[model samples]
Target chain A: MKLPKKVKINEVVLRDGLQLEAKILTLDEKKKIFDQLVKAAVQTIEFGSFVHPKLVPQMANSGELVELISENPNDVKLIALIPNLKGAKNAREKGVKNLNFVFSASDTHNEQNVQKSTKDSLSELKEILSYCKEQDICLSVSIATTFGCPFEGEVKKERIYWILEQLTSLDLETITLADTTGMANPQQVYDLITELTNKFPHQLFNLHFHNTRGMGLANMMAAMQAGVTSFDASLGGLGGCPFAPGATGNICTEDVVHMLHSMGIETDLSLDELLIASKTLQQLVGHETPSYVLKAGPYDRKYSIPTKK
Target chain B: MKLPKKVKINEVVLRDGLQLEAKILTLDEKKKIFDQLVKAAVQTIEFGSFVHPKLVPQMANSGELVELISENPNDVKLIALIPNLKGAKNAREKGVKNLNFVFSASDTHNEQNVQKSTKDSLSELKEILSYCKEQDICLSVSIATTFGCPFEGEVKKERIYWILEQLTSLDLETITLADTTGMANPQQVYDLITELTNKFPHQLFNLHFHNTRGMGLANMMAAMQAGVTSFDASLGGLGGCPFAPGATGNICTEDVVHMLHSMGIETDLSLDELLIASKTLQQLVGHETPSYVLKAGPYDRKYSIPTKK
Candidate 1:
């Protein structure tokens, strides 16, 4: 099980991370983070979600953020989340070329999170899918809570396969399985990703993991062995599931990249720039971030031994 | 690779966890934690170390701890750390049946940590080995910094294999490879454990990992897939390398058990009891412990959705 020579990491700090925070960053603050992430050589970025402002106030500035960034497709690609046709229309209006749509594999979580049943959410996705095609936007579907759900104890693999099957019918080429609550174990991750990749050989897959149970990196490693090469990580470990209580942040991007590079795996991202970006984010949030690499720098940086008494 | 149905976990909270703390636990406090661990069905417990009180005052009471524990072979086996021939003599006099002796794989770490050269440490280990054999005691040798060293940067696998060859000649059956600085990544863990296990088919190997870089559980899983079952965990993630500054605690016992049980692997240990024991340790240490399971209960516990407002 040799890992791929390079893995693509999509930074999601501005969207998934800030969505769960109590304080919202100003327009300039958001732009500073975006520029720093670009400086760090993150090729793909998910910066905003076009949800209703009333539902998630922290993300109220999504449209403005989308309008502010330069439309340079060669240097970097930007992705925004859209829940339904209305959000998709808003994203298109704001010229978001790349978009992510999420539907939970667990019915209870789907309804609670997006206010729609699984079947109805897929139906709603059809409208958004048509809108994406007409607007020439790249759409990537994410199956949230694909491993396990808080309300629904253990999510069956059949549910995920069925959802993926529906997305396959919709002609979506790329899909992501999100461990929204971080209930994934290594064996479960390995088995399920192996099955999914084998069953859908033509479709590209990405993994989004939460570090709630401290299995985030372990699960990512399992997915890597099972042939996954794209992962979504947050700068400074800054995201949590809004619906799941006690859920921690996403796997820290700097931590993941540091480990990967140390193992001779290539990411083409700079750990030093990522640390500087993480520090800037910490200042904006006015709190210490949860980055492991930021706290304990790269593995090569040795701490001087405390002087013997 | 399918993991073994049952895994053996050796709890090192009382010994490894407390030894790094600024405060020390009293004899009664230590006994209480030990009794709870017994009730929780931990088969092997490393209670304390037989080092000089002047060097590590926290473990000065190893002999007393050994004397206090009941001599029931069926209930729980007690293991203690022995640094030199003098510590081995004290452990033998106090009736410790199992002993662990550590030698750093890097010469610099060995010299800085124990104030001995690698050759000198191995020579000292030979005397301790003879004493343990004469006393009819089981001995496990730990190769510290098997993956990387703080001072030495990266440790070569050849060095670890050479050290293991020396211990193998001593007729020892089990050896634990310790990632003392949390410097191991998943690939290195998988490759090394697989090669070591293949080379020494009959020898038992255990992993002692630190969670400093957040790779502890990930490394544990890699070892598990490579056919290594036994692991060393500290309750509430209690221990770290005292000589390695900025290193964190060992992998948390409760968190590991939680993930294993969720994956349908049998550990035969109670998560609830471990949590209770973790809380007790937190109170005794006068600070919140670092166990993820203690923060978030088992994954099956449901979280109510936050109101949309």
Candidate 2:
């Protein structure tokens, strides 16, 4: 039940949430949500992506948002998602202080998702990490489809380790093992986290989960047992796997925060403030979000209006 | 996972599911579901409750169903629910060889549920266990609202132990901790089961989970780690608390079997066969069931019809 002194939650609303929406959120709306999120005690946030705007139009305003996060960099850590060397260079030129790069370990998914072989991605990662070190910018590599691949049935644990070894050799301590397709049951979560943490005890392992099979929070509990501290969650359960199959949404930040704070886990996140931000995001997108606690309210909130049957 | 060599899945369709039905299930229809459940390899079945017929007409057919199960005594084990001394005696007179008697541990729930205080129910349990011992009948006590109570909120872990201690003193070897309203989360499940198993290592423990907030299977896994092997599940997620506030359905047997079997955990029950019985029960009741796995099929089931948008 011991959580870190201050666990950093990397909010992925702007990039992941907006990309999944049919209606693209305006730059002003995204700014408002990000601004509210920072006010709610979130120190670090993944503001946007460096993907091709043609592939994901929702990320067309990445440069504008990154500039905004940098201006108010007093207490906030800003990060951007990079798909390849092209994305990494684009983010570095924008004076990005922190970057998150993703590559799938499942060779089938590595070919299908980013159209690059795993070995090629490793070479590209080595090149990018050298530049990232020169620029003194923090780097984290997310090994996506780490749990199970839609095309390939099971992603071996050893493959995940080799990918981590390549990344960790570059001296970046932070890494995320994402259940991109939501195939992680608690057993898988326990086994993988246990293996990685035991091998690389000094590295700060972060977990990113999706709730497609309704095991999002369950997987988190397993990760916590393995001493994982930081996690990634999208506001309003807004992310989906556009390429991988059956990933409905990322774990709702508000729900996980609520559960953690209520259980004496010391998340240091404001439940009421998080709820307000989630509802605002829902309204900004002009659609109901999948966050249950946001819609249902906390246990003490007596303002739950009785529904008219 | 090491499961029992010959596990008995006690189907709760007739007793648990129809309790909350707006329209009662007839004896003939309930018997048909029971027959189908047996065909599904459910070797043990909780037929019905021997409560006041005026209070619950849905389970008035307990006597008849007991008679039906008795005819195939070698093929299956039949259990009847007894709420009080009157119900216990009535079920006993019907020649039921096995019985499950439930009483709430939370004082507030005990008052609201059975109109008796927790101590009063404990007194009554002593009376009933002695009666059953005299008749050479098997008995297991279940503590309703063991996870949390609607009126009492969080029931203490000590309360569960005290009750189990009392039941053991009455020479009852088997008891179940029923998550009556599904407030049982994984941490709570782990804590309570560990405490119970540590205190009474040799006593047979069982879990009764509700899928209300969608943690039924996760809680089951936690309990399994805590050394719980036996469990109770109803077909199609049929039951709810009569006095409990905003309670959802029981843990669906088809769904539970599917999850257990998929994890290489042997349940000694066929998931596909349980699903067929669940579908038949759903049709017999002429309503949509609460089980998603039954309608959506198992995780790897091909040819799934897309859910309506």
Candidate 3:
């Protein structure tokens, strides 16, 4: 029955949403969605990716996205997802303030997902952290598939802690755990968040949840109870897990903001602008996006008669 | 990392699903879905209701559906929901062996939902239980809104226990905790299930989950870890909160079955048949169902190559 204090919503629709869709958005479409996201007042946004544009052509215009986002830096943090040192350098050159390097704790998962072993990924991470420090940029080491993987069920908790222990030593800006495949249940999420937070009291942590198993928002709730403040979500529940096989949808940014804000949690986001962003994103994708709050139009939608009507 | 030994999948789609939709299903469609569900090897199916069908016309075919299911009951148990003594008497007359009665643990919720206070509902339940015993029918007392309520926000653990304590004294055959509005997180689910299982060692209990807040399956997993064996799910995720606003979708039976079976948990139902039933239900509803498994297909589908050569 205890209520959580604060929640920060990090919109990832631009990164994860476009990653899965067959419909790749143009630079203008991406800009419109990003503009709407800023208007929505989401504190942090996964503005673009630093991975090979050849593999993910949708993000070919990453440099341009950073340029447009910089026009109004007003308090909103624009984050970029970088898989390695090369990606980190590219992001830094674009003047991206926050750099998120993605890694996998499970060896089998790491090899299949990013085509590198966990050790090799860690070595790359070590290379990236120093450059980020030199640039005075915030570094958040994102551990993907921290829960069970679709290919490899039941990811051991010890393996995750070992990676986290390394991240702690690096003394980066933040650490984030991602249920990349949506295989996480609430207990695993709670256990991981609580254990990590307890061990690293001074460290900053973030949660990235996916709605593939329909536990995305619930997993977020468990993490919030365990004292997490920041989160990564996609507008209109964009994004599907690349390694998750059958999974779909990231945690919907508008849905998270709606729930958190209504519960008296300070998210610093506007619901109307969130919905507008979702609508614009939906048009870019050429299909209805996965956000419930945006599509359903809030609690009073059914009962609310328009003033004009 | 030890998997569960077995899982019980009870399809609440017929009664729970149709009631949540804006339009009503014809009696003929209900009969067809019921027949498919029975063939799906669902050991138990919540087929219909014996309430004032006028309030929920989607269940108007309940009487007819119950009669049809009775003609070929076989070993599969057919359950019917009864709200009060009148409904209980009607269900008994119709030859339903498994009768379920839901009552709210919160006094305000009980009053708002059913136009009766908790005490009045309990008084009515005593009559229903007495009648169920005389007819040699198995009875289950379900406490709804056990985790959180829309009207009152968070529901206390002690309130849930008090309701269980009262029901235990009534000599009911079974009991269950319903996350009726999808307000339950894993810790809450685990804590309540563990406490109840310990206190009532001799009695059996089940967990009912909703996907409104998207934690349905995760909470179910936490409950399973806590030693709960039975669950209530709707095929194709066809359900929502009746009393509480902003709720959406019951826990999809196909997703739950897929997760459990892949983990090597036995459910005695055919996965393919379950999907077929879900698809059929979706077709009748004229929409893409809420179940991710139905849309995403099995894990193997992710690996399948698109054929065009």
Candidate 4:
């Protein structure tokens, strides 16, 4: 039950949340959500991904979105998801200061996601790292399918350890172990995170979890218990695994913040403002989002007493 | 990270899950669901409640449903929810062996639910206790809104401790602290349960949580860390708080069992069969359930890899 007094929430609604959305949000819509997030005091935001427009048409405006918001007065860290060296170059050209390089730990998933093997992805990470250093950009690496793969079932601890061994030497800002398809249980999250933190005490780690199987918040609790203080969450619980169609995406940003604040753990994010953003996103998506706090409201919310007949 | 080796799940879908539903299931439908639960090796089932038929039309057939399922050959513990001595008498007359008396810890909630104050409800519980003893029926008690109340924001820890003090002297089978509105956070659950368990070392306790704000499983984990080994869950995540419209009900039974099993904590319940029951319940309710496992399947399930073009 020991928890950190405060935690960092890296908002990923713009990237992971909107990637699987059908209706491509206009740049104005994306900026509206971004402004709401900033108003909620979200310090870190993954604005969007610098992937091919044909492959993921929803994120086609990542470059323009970054260029539009990079001049904000707030001390917010704006991040862009980069899948390869070309994506990295595109993000840098857009004046994006922070980049998250994602490659699945599972070779099959890595191949499917980026058309490259895990080994090839790692080899490419080196190039991305040197490029980031030369360009004075902050880079973080997210190893997707770190818990289990949709195609490969369980991703072994050894595989994660080896992947860490490769990236631990790099001058990366953080390493995120992602439950790409929401296949992680709490015990697995706790055990793996504990071992990883102990093995790489100097390496700052973040966790990205999906609520696909409804273990998202529980896994976050386990990760927190294992000393992880930073996480990635999507507003309105948007995004989905292509493999698990109809499953929920990342844990809802407002729900996560609500839970943390309720547990007396501070995230410095406003639940009310997050809810506003969540509502806006839901409207933009033109569908009901799987956000619990949005529907149920916060726990401390008081309802008028019913009159006895 | 110290979880119990095994946990007991008390299935409460029949009463708590159905009480709020718009559809009033017939006795035959209840029996079908009961059969499925029994097939899934569920040892404990809250068959139905003995509340006024006009109050909860969905549970109007509780008497007939209990009578039809009580003759089953399985070693299942069938329990019924009773609000007062009258309900208790009705359940006993229907040949129910176990009765659960529920009263809210919040005076406003208790008054609204049963037209009585907290003290009056406790007094009535004494009458029900004597009646159960006279009839040789096992009795348990559930204190609703043990964490917080919709009408009364936060129910103090002292209030819960006071309620426990009043009930500790009674010959109850087990005492359940219910988060009726799903307001209890993990730290609060851990702190309160730890203190209560330490104070009442001889008492057996169960926790009932709703996924109202989506912290149900995380709260369960925290309770387990505090040494609680039994919980109440609903099939297909079926119930909802009357106060919070559209909020999810109790944690899904299959999802809970799936998580426990994944963590290597044995529950002795067949997950596949539970899913079958969940599916049947969904069809009977004529709506998609809030069950994550039913939609996404289990984590161990491997998806067929798509062939490259």
The lDDT for every candidate, in the order shown, is: 0.85, 0.76, 0.77, 0.92
**2 versus 4: better lDDT goes to:** 4
Task: State the DockQ, from 0 to 1, for candidate 4.
Answer: 0.85
lDDT of 4 by residue, A1-309 (tens): 779999999999999999988899999999999999999999999999999999999999999898788877687899999999999999888899899999999998998889999999999999999999999999999999999999988899999999999999888998998999999999999999989889988887899999988999999999999999999999999989887779889999999999999888999898999999899888888999999999998999999986667
**Candidate number that wins on TM-score, 2 or 4:** 4
Question: Which one wins on lDDT?
Answer: 4
What is candidate 1's lDDT per residue for A199-288, written digit by digit as tens? 877777889998888888888988898889999999988888654545568999998998899789999899899999999999998887
Candidate 2 regions off by >4 Å? A1-8, A28-36, A57-74, A89-96, A131-136, A236-248, A278-309, B1-18, B21-40, B52-74, B89-96, B133-136, B211-215, B234-248, B251-255, B275-309
Clash statistics: count for each candidate: 0, 0, 2, 1
Cα miss at B35, model 3 (Å)?
A: 5.5
The model with the greatest TM-score is 4
Tens-digit per-residue lDDT, B1-309, candidate 1: 468888889999988888888888899889888887887889999999988898788999888887888564447988888777788888888888888888799988888778898879999988888888888988888888898988879888888888888787687746889988788988899899889878877778889998887888888888888888899999999887554444568999998999889888888899889989999899888787668778767778887766756
Candidate 4: regions farther than 4 A off: none
| lDDT (10s digit) by residue, model 2, range B75-144 | 6888888888888889888889888888898887777667799989989988888889999988888899
Q: B194-309 in candidate 4: lDDT tens per residue?
A: 99988989987999999999999999999998999999999999999898789999999999999999999999999999999999999999999899999989988898878877
Clashing pairs in 1: none
Ten consecutive residues with minimal summed lDDT in candidate 2 chain A?
Answer: A299-308
Which 10 consecutive positions of candidate 4 chain A have the poorest summed lDDT?
A: A66-75
The prediction achieving the highest DockQ against the true structure is: 4
Error of 4 at B43 (Å): 0.9
